[model samples]
Target: MIVKKRRRPLPLTVLSTTFVLLWVLMAAFPFIWTVWGSFKVEQDFFSRDSWWFAIEGPRTIAQTGSAFTGDGYYGAWVLRDFFSSVVNTIIVTVSVVVISLTFGTLGGYALARSGYRYTFWLLMLALVFRAMPHITLVSGYLLPFFEMNIWGHLPTAIIVLVAINQPFTLWMLHSFFLSIPKDLDESAMVDGCSRFQAFRMVVIPVMWPGVITTGLFSFLLAYNDFAVTAMLLSQPNQTMVPKIASFLGTIQQEGNVMFAVAAVVSATAPLFVLVMFFQRQIVSGLTAGAVKG
Candidate 1:
């Protein structure tokens, strides 16, 4: 029969798998290279064995003319300044997240539940501020803090970070709040709850995912900020992101163990924790919003 000549179909599954793998590599190449490079010695950073040239971390420093060695990630982690900066980053991120969520949730609930007409304009203004280039905002405010001796402490940075983060946070939370049925509010009031009580008991519980998402967004945004933190904070209180950048600049001429250690510890670790902690909530909140609309 003609079936005797049946041909095998092209291995589309293999092709699709290959394409997905390639895309993931393309998306993750920088992070992967950075992680590998974290294990490299500073002296080896520019060597032939360096990932900059070889697509993975350095294996040996040329200075020794001998075998490769370990970079001193252990020592870098013990560096008092590294630890201090890490503390500062954590404090900043946590503060921003909590404050942003507290304020954003309240503001969002008000706008969505109160039927305010001005919310659209307020939202537009928020988009404008968020859309403004980070460099420009940092530069514009730098002199006021650096030159004028205004609120030039860590508090200033916190304030600026929170203000910059709030608009989008409020908008995102507002969308989430709007997705909740108004019938819930009515039912709560019918059950002897006031507006504030209803929000506290009914709305807030259901909106926790959105609140968590906004908090993580704010935390990550504050934690990873470079220009703003650099401009606002200094010395022992400098945020980890800017400090890491400083380390990269100084290590350009040396063995990169310290830089690698700092890069991995400062930049990658918190982000990993953040993703792991709130990953499910983030997905659920985002998906719920999408489906609701």
Candidate 2:
């Protein structure tokens, strides 16, 4: 039998692995700590005596007669009506994603397929809009929304989010469309398909990887947005992020720090599940335009 030789990892490889592990720990540890703390009362969780009090769960056991308690979740979700915020968030996120994708795909397809000189200028204009801070745009809308009497509603937030989300969506989908071979659509048209038919039959199926990626981003933006939602929405129309923020202001008076922590954990869980489930599609979509073949 031939002798086998083992190769040692390069120093750069070792360094990179160490760095990645450290970054993951740094990112994930706080969320993990918060989840653990959510089961404990404020005193034990935040105790200066020892950090292990949160892990030991003695106070938690005494209060709930178990090693863990879900009072925080109950207090936030049921007692405080956090589920309404969840519903509002879902409505805005879904509406924004659908509307943004519809317009973005059409706009991107035109930009990709057209040979017009105005396309460049249009894209540059979109870039300018994208680079502007969203808060600045929100200020401009406040007066108009008040005049229109549509302020502090789901529709208003959805429209604003869609408009704000469009520029980036257009640019991203434009790049994705460029990655696809034009001949695919041309071939479909040659087979007696209309332009829209060609897109529907040939382009759309292939473009989904990129679409899914862009949609995921849109979902994230709408879901995590605090600045716009907090300013524009009425108290009853608040989303999860803003609601969690409201908790911070009232936590001192209410002594419900665990409720805020539990809300954070609740809000984070869906994103975690989403990322875990669609990680492959996300990676593929991000990398679709990186290589030609």
Candidate 3:
């Protein structure tokens, strides 16, 4: 009986695994260190004696008789009213997702269905706008927003975010719509349903995977935006990202760096939860649009 030899793993596979491991470590270490330090007092965390002071939190042990404490969280959340920023961020993210998805679905379906000569040009124009730096667009809005006296309001920021985010939204949803067969809607139409009814009854249900993925991108844009929110929103109306930036300025003076650290951890928790729950949809949506029937 002749036995076949087992093949060894390729060098490229080993290298790729190593690279991925290193990248994950690099990305995860900062957040892990920040969370570890958040439980420490300022002195222990920033001490020159040893970086291990942060890990051990000796000062926290001496004061609270525990190596960890909730002071940082309490200070940032209760005293600093970080909840308000959280609320603002949630509102902006939800509003942007809803508005962007609504408009993007209708506009993208139209572009995908239409045989007009201008459709290609329209898509290219959207691509150009999407590629342009958002800051440039923010500048033009400043004057108009100031004139209308709507600068620094949540509604104004929501509207601007919707506008800035639309180009990418249209492009992504348009591609997803292209992957779907036009015959699907036509079949529904042949069954005595109107165009809108066909779309509502047949297409929308199948379109959700793409929509969820697109909405995730929209949420990230609105949630992670600091430049637009900082420039356009008033102090009270600021979102979590800008609020985090503001913490850096006063943390040193206040001698409460851990508060900022805690706030950073708090802010990151939601995104982690979001990914954990919807990662499957995100993957499916991305891959589904790449192939066409």
Task: Compare the candidates by lDDT and give the number of the best one.
Answer: 2
Off by over 4 Å in 1: 1-11, 43-45, 49-70, 146-148, 256-261, 283-293
Candidate 3: misplaced stretches above 4 Å?
1-6, 9-17, 284-293
lDDT of 1 by residue, 96-151 (tens): 88888888888889888876678788878888987998889888897767667854
lDDT of each: 0.73, 0.88, 0.87
Q: Which lDDT value does model 3 have at 114?
A: 93
Candidate 2: tens digits of C-alpha lDDT, residues 157-272: 99989998989888889988998999999999999999999988899999887898999988988998887999899999999999999988888744388889889999999999
Total clashes, candidate 1? 6
All candidates: TM-score: 0.81, 0.91, 0.91
How does candidate 3 score on lDDT?
0.87
Q: Output the lDDT of residue 282, model 1.
A: 67
Clashing pairs in 2: none
**Candidate 3 residue lDDT tens string, 1-293:** 88998776799779988999999999999988887888888888888788889888888899788998999899989988899999999999999999999988989898988999899999889889888887888898899989989999999999889988998888888888887999999999999899889878899899987888999888988988877998899999999989988988886565468788889999998888988999997776566546531
Q: Which model is ahead, 1 or 2, in terms of TM-score?
A: 2
Clashing pairs in 3: none
Clashing pairs in 1: 41-256, 42-255, 42-256, 42-257, 43-255, 51-56
